[model samples]
Target chain A: MKRLLLLLAFAGVVALMAWGFNQAIFVAPTEATMGDVQRIFYYHVPNAMLSFLFFAISFVASILFLAWKNSAPERAQAADAWALASAEVGVVFCSVVLITGPLWARPVWGIWWTWDARLTTTLILWLIYVSYLLLRRFAEGAQMQTLAAVLSIFGALDVPIVYMANRWWRTQHPAPVFGGGPDSGIKDPTMLAAFGWNVLAWAAWGLMLLAFRVHVERRQQRIRHHQTVAALAGK
Target chain B: MSGMNDNSGSQNSSSKNSSSKKSSLKNSRSLRIVVAVVVVLGTIGYLAYTGQASAKSYYVTIPEMQKMGAKAYSSNLRVEGFVKPETIQQDGPNVRFVLSEYESHNPKAQQNPRQITVDYRGSEPPPDTFKNDAQALAIGTWGQDGVFHATQLQAKCASKYAPAQGAATSGAKVATNEAPVVAHGNRTN
Candidate 1:
């Protein structure tokens, strides 16, 4: 029954993604100024928003892992698993954002890149999380999880800085298309609809990926536990 | 009694020697720590100072640029202003244009504003979005000739991404309704 439920969820997500893609391409009006190039916005913005969300989940999980370390070892391990999974997924989504952003910017901004605060801060965020993932991979000894969890928290802090980069500074990047004061936001309902659908689809997809990663990590942890038991018995 | 005094005097000297050695070691370690701290702080201070210096203002407005006097002419800087109508003169990748404090998008904001002439030469053609009423940011040095000599130029569309007039206002539901029909046709093919 659980497997069937998971299958249903997967099917639902695929359908949502297809629907969102259709909305973005066909339903959204071509932006008057940018024409077809503006379609990239539907993809880039959603990926960026989802990256922040996954990082936020990772941050909370890390905090919980730290809090439960001594009192409940099992719970701490579970939280640590969650931290690693979400952070890895977050980096994947952030990579998409980083790649898609340059693709969109090259044509629109005329230059492939700029060192504006928004772009610089986003690059830093990606680097921070990439380092976090690396720390998890190669770190040695008992305190590895603790160290990684702390780094996860540090990485999560960059999310807010990335989000507010444009708001706080004058940048080559444009102001927010949504919630960017008055004169900002989608002028047309159709574009807004397309944007809304893409955000929902990408978010659901990211969450699904996070769950699968966590499940795999838990299994690995159990295997490690069994190996340790065997080693103790041998000794 | 003499033998006991000799042993006691030697013991006191050795004790004094070890105490001095320990004190010297502690002093050297503290000096090393102080040097390390100063180096770390100096690096941080240098980075912060330079980071703020470059990033403090992404671009200066035409009015502010004008007020800067000779200082503006000396350094590489970015100045943003709205492109004046009918003033674009294109020369391959290089262009001559006039920018004004009067934003072409919001005419109601100012009737007449300050103006500046810019000369831009770039390796690539000016961006497609460059046009009359567009906001342009020119990065280079200001010149004594009253023309801003620019090595890099960037433009923002005057419309700023408002949808085109035709089908943009149509209901989203109506468009999606047609999407399935197109998909089904493609499947048959």
Candidate 2:
């Protein structure tokens, strides 16, 4: 019955996500100036925003783990699991942002990528997370946790600088889409409402997925510890 | 004191042994394979996405557009510079014109100043300000005879007006210095 309830909840969320996505896709008209290509903004912008949120989570969890070593091992273990979960989700969103961003750029900028501030910073953030995951896998117990946390916090620091530099650097890509930047392309009430709802829906979905992943991880860790203890007793 | 020291030493040794066993279990072939696959796929996907996005903007200057010959003219491209006076032609829904850099104040220069003629079949070009001496980006195909046939025209708005000049003084005034570029012919539509 518990499993069934969880399944039903997951399905309900998926349906909501689909409905919200359709609202963003169809309700919004092609921009008067940019034409059909502007539709990429609906998914691309939200994913970028959410990716940063996940990266932030990874940084915070890493800090908590490093500072409170004397606390029960469970707390640090939980934080590590959550941090990895967030990192995996973040990497996926970063991938999407990297993809759709170029699609929108091709027709307008005449190139697939630029050394623009936002693009470079996002790419760097992606690389830092990649290294964080690697460090976790290779290092030993306390060392792994400590190194991953330090790397993560430093990486999160880069996000704000990336945003600021994107503004400060002169690039062909327009200003913020959803925000009231130069490209306030969205004036329609239906479109704005749809964008807002979809961002919220996706963010919630991502958090739920992270939670589920962390739960599984913690259970697996407990099983391993129990097995180790049992095997020692047998010996 | 020796008993306590021995117990501490044994505890440390046991913890080290256990951690090494856990580390050995983690370094399995399957784990390595999973990591490799994820990294390889992610990099390839990133490259492909970036390639697709950078394909659209104008890639050449006016002179470069002129040199590429007939095939270059047919491909959709962006060409920049000032719209040349007296060379613009309108026939039915199509418009043909040459864009050239103004030869400065000097009249006697070599090589007829590189220009592109556009065969534009799009909307009526923006007002008189969209004519000679105005900076514009013309999107369309170039013609065999050096015309850039623009399907779309984007003109840079005049930027010299000081805020102090105010709209009341210059807003209502119409430009009457030269004959409008469209005087020669009209669009059939």
Candidate 3:
């Protein structure tokens, strides 16, 4: 039954991705101004939004790991696994956002980069999460997980700041397409649909990636437990 | 009996020596961590400081740029306004244009808007989005000749590009006339 469910979910995600690709490239009208180059918006924005979401998930999981560490170590390990998985996926998504953004900006904004509040805050956010991942990889002490948890929390704090940067400051970055005041949002229904389909597709793909990572992490944790027990028995 | 006592004494001292060495190693490790954190934070702070100081706002209004007077000429400045329709002239990589205070695309906006001329001599060509009524930001220095001598030019569609009502007929023009501008992609003020 579980195998069937997993297979179904995998199929569903693939379908969603196919539909989204069609919507973004084929169905959606060529943008008025930048033409096809504007289509980068479909991929770039959804990735950015998902990256923030995954980071938030990591933050919550990190807090759970820290809180339950002493009383329920097994639960804490599970939470830590989740935290690690989410952080890894978030970084991947963030990398996509950073890369895709430059591609769009070069033709539209005429510059590949700027030091506006929005861009700067986003870059900083990526750096903090990257450092968190590095700490998890290299730091071997017993307190490494705890340290990474604390760092994850700090990194999550930047997420909100990044979202708010353009709103609070006039940036080289464009204002939010939705809810950015009077003139914001997609005017054409087709454009909006294309954006919607891509958002669903990318998010589903990201969630599946996160789940796979968590499963791998949990298996590794269990193996580590077994190794330690066997080593102690040998001693 | 003396030999046995000496052996025990040596063993005890050696254990003590090892423990102290371990403690010192741990201390240095933590000290290194603290130093690393401080250095990373300090570097980010310094970079953020310099980056923001160079371009404090996305783009300053033309009046604000004019008010800066001597400061505008001495330091880097980013001035934003609507490109007056038909004022854009390109010569190789260089372009000359006029910017107006109000949204040029908006029919309801002020007709005789405050205007400034821009002389953009950047190595790179202006983006394809640069066109009539587009919102353009020019970055460089104000010359003594009263022209904004731009080292760079960034352009996007005005906010009026929204295809609110009647996107089928009018929306084509609305969406096509002005290209999609970036959100949060901005300037060196």
Predicted structure with the largest TM-score when compared to the true one: 1
Error of 1 at B71 (Å): 1.1
Give the per-residue lDDT digits (tens) of candidate 2, residues B1-189.
577556655787877577557667866755985686577567645644553355333335686666777767569876666566666676755566667754222252134776666667775544333554445567777666555666666553221111111111221122122221121111110
Best candidate, lDDT-wise?
A: 3
| Candidate 1 residue A156 C-alpha distance from true site, Å | 1.3
i-RMSD values for every candidate model:
9.5, 14.2, 7.2
Task: List where candidate 1 sits over 4 angstroms from the true fold.
Answer: B1-56, B108-110, B157-160, B169-189
Residue-wise C-alpha lDDT for candidate 2, range A1-235, written one tens digit per residue: 9999989979877987888777665554333233344456667878888998998888788777765655767788888777777887887788889898787666544346766556777889889888887887787566777777768877787776555543454333454554425324455555466668778778878887887888887897788779889999996
Off by over 4 Å in 2: A178-185, A231-234, B1-189
Docking quality category of candidate 3 according to DockQ thresholds: incorrect
Q: Which tens-of-lDDT digit does each residue in A111-181 have in candidate 1?
A: 87888888998999899899988888888544999989878887787777688777777788887876776
Interface RMSD of 3: 7.2
Which 10 successive residues of model 2 chain B have the least lDDT summed?
Answer: B180-189
